[model samples]
Target: MLTSIEVAGTAQVPATDVGFLLYKHPDRVQQFATSQGGATVFFPAASPELCRVVLHVDGVGAKVDRAEGMGRYVNVVPFAASSRLVVVLGKVFGDALAGRCATRPELVDNRWPMTLTVPSVPTGGRCSPAELFEPLGWTVQTSAQPLEPPQWGDSEFVTISLSGVHTVRDALRHLSVCLPVLAGAKHYFVDDAEVDKLQRLGDGWLDTHPRRDDIAAGYVKHVRSLTDEAVMRLAGDVTTAQPADDANAVPERRASLARHRREWVVESLARAGARSVLDAGCGEGRLLAELVTALPGAQIAGVDVAPAMVDRARERLQRWRGTSVWQSSLMYTDPRCRGFDAVVLMEVIEHIEFDRLPTAMSSVFDEMAPRTVVITTPNHDHNEAYGLAGQWRHPDHRFEFTRADFAQWCASVAEEYRYRVTIDGVGEPVEGLGAPTQCAVFTRDDSSPQLNSSEGGRR
Candidate 1:
């Protein structure tokens, strides 16, 4: 099986710089491996008058295992416009999708007139092309293909053509999010990470999309819990309070509180005499950037599981000296993250699954074992203070911890690792409720023989 996509440039905005945008030269044929098989990306034509790019994906052959004897197995893996294509697109055109065009800086921010075509995309009888793209400002044309004669009725696949003016980044973002929804099933398993991917890639446009529910359902394969959470997040109803008389006041207050949280983290690190810091789960490097300004002499490094977030963080800290950003998960032990004097998990723990917390804690405490470790998570008890009772601050959060819950977890981990723990609050404190965010700081006990042996052995 094969699936492919073609993109053509318009006369006014010729696609001459398409190669630069994709970070692949027109003269080269790029091949990437996929779960099913391989994908090849090449430019069919390249010139000022016209430019075209094609992505061709091949499916792998199916083989039966000898262990399962005498049983018939069917390989129903989807190959057309599936998550495989999304993965290939990310590999071949990630720079373009991320809106990075160093060679053609002038075109980075401009919307180019172009035409996009996908020859064989499975719609799964969910929706029409017009219904999905028209509302997103694209002019759509679709043609359905028929299934095999006599054996089956109409096929679920369709050829779609979209013409519009859009930034390459926006166009690719739309395709990456919508293509899997159209396929109706993923090539890989769905998990909370899938929800985070959707939220991150669909950050700007998905919130207001007219077919958001349909899109969310299709993307997550209709897993009720995942779909509901995605939809709630995109709708901005997860933790937002009802409109009050002073709408501006609420937003202003929230911004101030966020600033306070970051400031507290930085001040605490400085007080601990931390000269080197690792910002674990540093999404977009917001706190990392602030740390750069606040502690000009301190060495800074950031790590994130998402490549896109790491890329953004790198861009944000490009000018800062002695600062590094890379893509890596905190769930496993990483040699590069082992020697920092301090590690900050600011506003990150709540997003991790409960089952995975132990691995993350072990990696930080037993493996890296920074002198000081700081973590902050949402205060569940404080939600009601903002008129959001029994609601989480973000949909991607696997579990939010109240003050007691957070403190208990921290104390247990500290005890297991020979460290002393202290807890504090961030943001405004309510009478009976607590602050919107809670912080836990863990310090290695200097008297511990394990700490002394580890340091002495290194010397």
Candidate 2:
């Protein structure tokens, strides 16, 4: 299997910097030994205008095992990019895939005009090339080859070329997770740890992708339990909480766990005597709608990073005058978010990458400085109720906190910001399992001095 990445450069910005981002010097040709064969990485064209890095793997096909009856007769590994290719490439570009750059850290987050070429890819007759790649912003082109014209219709493999603007890290991670999904096979054992690998590489994009379920199923080789858990984790709803005691419980009054969580936030906001509220990461305005009804006279606003979500929220809340929804990221400070009596980041913080979590927290607590701050995240302690023990509820979640862990984090933040905090559960508890959602309410201490927006809060 052969795959390559070519980066185009402009007069001002040269493609040579890609070396720093990838930590691969263009002057050197590196080779590594693999179980099936050998893999080599080299730059065929290295210049300021353009640079192309090629990864060539040889002898993998002969070692790959075909079906039981077919034996050594036919193997598609050589002609197709499979999990084996992912393994080789992953080993070669581990640091790049993780967005780590010691020399040029800023370049790791930058998107560049680049083209990715995979000579042969087998779609396993399940999905089209466009279906798998187009949704991720890649413009795809495919060419089919024939084995022997009349005798054999057409080869199952296709040569695919993908062009797009993407960060080197994202591109590497995408290929790492997508190749196995596309080929519909894995050379290694499919186990619980595979889910973590998928999540780690597929972060930021996979959870929101349109073909997430299909990708998860194929990546894990369609293990039913693993597939179910993965799909639920990507959807952020791993479990539908059922009554603890079916025989003794009333079915008529039961509601969704999400609704319960929203209700809890609304109640907490009301109890805090909030006259104005800001809903950070207000996805589709679900909680915003409830907030409007629960607090009629309150000045309420919603902000989200996705423009599509903001547009949806605008339409959802358009009927409610005086309420505004706009697109904004929580990672940076926004003057518009100031002067709110309360701010609710329901199920938001966990979505942030752990490295960036500090910046986001400082933006909300130190920059916005609302009188009351309410936050909620998935409680991993309740994963057993969802049959997801030792696994995260959502693939996009950077980390889910157990009750003790959540309390410790809350206490640290409260102490640093001088806020009185309280912890509670959103969903009904299941004895030792606790609630599926954990909530933390942070109220500014009475004695702590308050800074106005002009002062830029407490910094």
Model 2, 84-181: lDDT tens digits are 78877777787898889987798888788999999778777355778878999999999886677658877767788989999999888878877777
Off by over 4 Å in 1: 1-13, 61-78, 148-153, 239-459
| Candidate 1: residue 458 Cα off by (Å) | 45
Q: Give all candidate RMSDs, comma-separated.
A: 10.8, 18.8
- Candidates' lDDT values, in order? 0.75, 0.80
TM-scores for all candidates: the values are: 0.50, 0.51
User: Model 1, residue 450: displacement in angstroms?
Assistant: 31
Candidate 1 matches the true fold with a TM-score of 0.50
